[model samples]
Target: MLAALRGIAAPPDLPLIQRRNFLRVQIDAIGVGLASAAAPFLPIFLTRLGATSQEVSYLTSMPALTGLLLGIAIGQLLQKQRNIVRWFSAARFLVLLAYAVTALLIEVVPSAWLIRAILLLWALVTLPQTVVAVSFNVVMNGVAGPQHRYDLMSRRWSILGITMAITTAVAGQLLEHLPFPLNYQIVFSLLSLGSLISFAFSSKIELPPQPISNASRTNSVFTRLSHLLGQIWREKPFVRFVSIRFIFLIGTTLAAPLFPLYYVREVKASDAWIGIFNTAQTAVLLVGYFAWTMISRARGSRFTLLVTTFGVSLYPILVAHTHQVQVIALIAGVAGFFQAGIDLVFFDELMKTIPDGQSAIFVAVAQTLTHLSSFIAPIASAWLSDLYSLPIALTLSGIIRFLGFGLFLTLGRKDS
Candidate 1:
């Protein structure tokens, strides 16, 4: 298994620089996986802490709010800078630091203020988060270049998936076996150490210096802003892709908070079961990434996109009908398979839409649109879940996803 994974990830005949960067990218994935192990549990922790749905929705909504405000500005700022990897590494460090802060807050903050404090901490980190979001694509695209993106990302994400699977399983066991609050505190603190690993290796990723933008340093901020808008307007493909993706993202994000809420409230799943849920999904991604990469290679990204988009649209609806955690884990596994395809196709398609030398700014525009949906969807879903039932809200999510899938069937076929 390990050898096969290596065979898939590490293709031969690369120059020395790309080879080294590829290895570094995979190692960085391990660190990322470790840190991301804490993600599924954050909302679970909030729920256990007696946080209301609106407060819980803040986890998704706050970052989106900040991203909407800061994403484009950060993108433009990065375009001006010569070394985006520096910005990428620094931003990643701060974003991961929030988990460590959350760990400390569990010990020191008053019970009444804990949720607010965590939410505020996350909100404040959105600045760096925006930087990371913008710079990440730039850095990764630089590392993979045009020819090796699928190879690099598939291996990178596969490693990340396996790492996340193991760590999340351990985290679930720790949460089940260890005492409350302290178990969480320990898990968060230890998991946060992955940030240091991420920072160290990510900082070492060597990209050729970006050519500085020549947009006239003398231009007023408004002038530059107008220029940026003009650039985006001219990229008709990017505009159309972002528009369709915005709708798809709404369906995905609307179901985000509802899953944990349903698992915790409706299903009454234990911590161990939640871990299994995440584990099942992530473990499948290891296979999914490789499988979808082959499918994309053979059938093209357009076909892959249609199939995967339609496949994933069924996840929430399937979960809505089931009450058993075991069955839900199976459903999550199915979702993970298609989700891997979506990630690969989306990244490839988005990068294809971006013109050379405009990765940061173009990706920023996309992220800003994504944040717009992320901001509205979760809160809306939470409201729907609150007003109706979890199943009803989840069914609505599937319905919306089907609509996005329909758009893909028509508009997605036009992509080259």
Candidate 2:
């Protein structure tokens, strides 16, 4: 493995100031990998334990709702706290318990309703992990500085993708040997162990001190929005970028809930194949993210984001046409590559166009739009899928996403 890694071309050298933060970045990358490797397999595990389609749908959407509420609250709380690493670490540790519960109950509760209840409970438990992710974004931006932000974040994601791919492959092989409930329990136990690695490495990283504050708190959403809107209005690029974010996310969410279902039901994918598909997806993401990091460092985030969004617009069409399990898995993997390129640079690019004071607010707005879309889109996708066919639903999503891409292009133009 060491020799193979050494054969890989090296990343662009970071300046001395930025280089020291690499260890923290690695730890964050590892944590993200561990968490993500567990995600694609959860619905698979639930289904094996007897969860229905509707139950799976509920499980998927419930997390988004809970994440939205908890993420907002945590964003507010972080504004007051001085130290965030401990909180971030603790949240990750606790969130693993959600998986533990699933593992523990999969054998005992074979009923669909009982399993759905467990999923709902798991959503509530998993929320803090979502909030902790905000802390990561904040800290990483600080560590990398504005100039290196996109490259640093992209590299982190590359590392995450690689780790997840490798781990999932190993887990898949191990899981193939086990049967039913035992297989799921073993996976969760391993996932929890991975969480321990995150906890341990996190404790090693030193955090920058937060500036002391002596101000009273104001807790009104409308009041916060009033202040944020004025700030965003003053910044045209920020406004344009965030609008693009909102539109793209709306289209993405419109299709997300249906993707797994389509693969499982329409394409008739097995659990092992789904794991391989996920592994392939992450592998492509790892490659794409690193490549984009190198490209965007010189070409600018706006250009890279535009190109990548165009790539993602092609995903729905590819996915729609794919009938065979292998073909679907291939398209899914390639889709992740495109998504990675967009994900790495887009937000950091958006921040480049915003005032430092307004970064959190803008991030919050983008996240809120994403979450709101998540809540709304799934029901629509479900209805459309039920009424028409999965392919039609996917094709429709592709068209809308392309429209979003066009809207993004129109952002800086006044007379268009």
Candidate 3:
């Protein structure tokens, strides 16, 4: 901890508080690490616990489904209270507990019904993490400012990507070496420890002052939401930007639910292999993140996003074509490279659309929409994949990317 603080304090341009924020961001990276570590293996974990492809698809949808309902409520709560650090702390703790439960009870759970129940329970446990995501983005936006948001998010993700990549690689090795259920148990154990570290780090963060008024506080949050809607409608560029984002999200999410199932069922990759694939992807992402951090600083977020979007637009096609393991890994690496850039650009652009003093609202709205899209994706993708094929779904995803490109060319042109 002292080492982290000392490291943060050494940055030339950072003030004392900025230095503290930097440490917090690094601490926040631990949660990012846990999530990333789980990402590659979670589908396999479900499979080991007797989940089918359809069940895996549904499980993938659970977090977004839970977030769709809970995210808005969390946003409203953040609007009233300024103790965001505490909210973040609570969220991490819940997520940690959830991981522990999933690790301990996964083998004992009986029937598909039990699997579904556990998934929903897992989703419930992770909802606060979603809330914490919005809070983190909102708070960080304020702290970092628009100019620095690009740099901050990039640097933070770079560090996060590095940490997560290392952890994932190590976990992958452990999985490769360990036995069936025990391997998963060990992975989840690591995740729980990471979450606890994240919680402890979050607890050290200083809370900012609340800005809501007495009258505003007394009024119903719905009325405030209505006013916010009015403002959103009144602001043409903001509306356009958000509309474009929503459209892009819909297209991007179309095949998301099927991805895990595609790898598990179609490709027939083992848990260890999946972890290795993820490690390869994260390695690519780490490189991409650092490269973009440099480019985002030089070229601006708009330019960075445009280039990255074009690159990301190609991944589905790559994924659709690949048959060999090495080819798949290469494809994944390519996707990761572009995704790092896309994420940095997306956040930077989104921050610009948020109204002053209402960062949390817009951030929450974006998150809500994202989760809603994710929730809908599984059913839609599953139906489509059943009717046509996963290739068709990928084709559809590509088309959506092209549409997003069109939006960028026409509507978002000036913003960029």
Candidate 4:
């Protein structure tokens, strides 16, 4: 792994600053990997804590609700800042802090109140999370510039994927071996340590000074917002892509809360099996990132997007039909491969649409749309699950995803 990282950082023509930034970004991904290892388990923890499907849905929707309200405002704020890296690092730290808080709360909060307390904690976390969401792309895009986005992100995600896979495997074993809440507490605490590493390295990333626009400062917030919206509206490609992506995202977010429910409630998967599921998915991402990067270079982002979207759209339906946990893990690996392509292509395509010097606001606009879908979809899926069944809800999600894929197939083109 070290050799691979060194090879990635070894482009002799790359500027010293960029080379250093690449290393920092890779290191930060390690921290991100460690922190994210906690992700698959959080909802599982909530389920074990006796949370309802609606409450579990809150895990996804609550964050989106905050992002829906605050994404644009935070984006505008980031655009005004001379340095967004600071905001990005700070927000990341605060978000990671919530995991530690969750760990602490496990000891003191009554079992009945624990779910509510955890929900409230994350609700407060959404403020900083919104900042992270808006500023992360700005900072990373600035660091990679237009030319190196694929190379930088591919390497970073590969590192992140491997780290997450390893740590997640370990986390699963910990959960299986230790007592209930204690095992989770330790996992959360251990994972939160990554935030310190993230903060330290991410703060060191150097980017060219932002070209701040003063025209908005003199205007009322509402007028400035209107101007920003008007700017986004005129970018036809941005509008079209964001609209299509929004539809695709509904399918994505709708399935978010249902997976753990399916794994735990429907399949009765053990903690060890859950860990294997995540590890299988994440471990394949290294190959997925490499393969997709090559495909994007050869076939273009449009082709990559269509293929990946269609492939990923099949995942929920596959899971819905399969009863075996091992088969689901295999399916997850295949889905992760396509998911990597979607991640890369989506970022590249969205960045392509933004006008120069307006990444923050544009990204915020995109994120806001994402949050709107996220806020609605998970709740709706939960309702479907409650009223009917998990398999039924998951099938609907796959259908929505296929519709999005069809739209991409028909309308997504360079000239369109």
lDDT per residue for candidate 2 within 1-416, as digits (tens), equals 63333223223465443454555566656875875677777767665666655566665566567656765666666656667667666776677556666666765775655576677677677577566656666666766677767656677778888899987877777777788667877887677566667777655555665553343165467776576567668877766676677777767877876777777778777667778888888889878987787787677665777788888988887888887878877787888888888877675765577566433445555565566667667777778888898889888888878988887676543311
Candidate No. with top TM-score: 4
Worst 10 residues of 4 by lDDT: 3-12
lDDT (Cα, tens digit) per residue for candidate 4, span 270-316: 99999999999999999999899999889888889889999999999
Please provide, for model 1 over 330-405, each residue's C-alpha lDDT reduced to its tens digit, 9 standing for 90 to 100.
9999999999999888888899989998898899999999999999999999899989999999999999889988
Compared to the true structure, candidate 2 yields what TM-score? 0.87
Instruction: Write down the TM-score of every candidate.
Output: 0.97, 0.87, 0.91, 0.98
Q: Please give the CA lDDT of all the candidate structures.
A: 0.90, 0.69, 0.72, 0.90
Give per-residue lDDT, candidate 3, residue 36: 56
Candidate 2 backbone collisions, by pair: none
TM-score of 1: 0.97
Candidate 4 deviation (Cα RMSD): 1.4
- Stretches off by above 4 angstroms in model 1 are 1-9, 412-416
Question: What ranking emerges by TM-score with the best candidate at the front?
Answer: 4, 1, 3, 2
Order of candidate numbers by lDDT, starting with the best: 4, 1, 3, 2
- The predicted structure with the larger TM-score, 2 or 3, is 3
lDDT of 3 by residue, 11-46 (tens): 547667766776776777767677557665766677
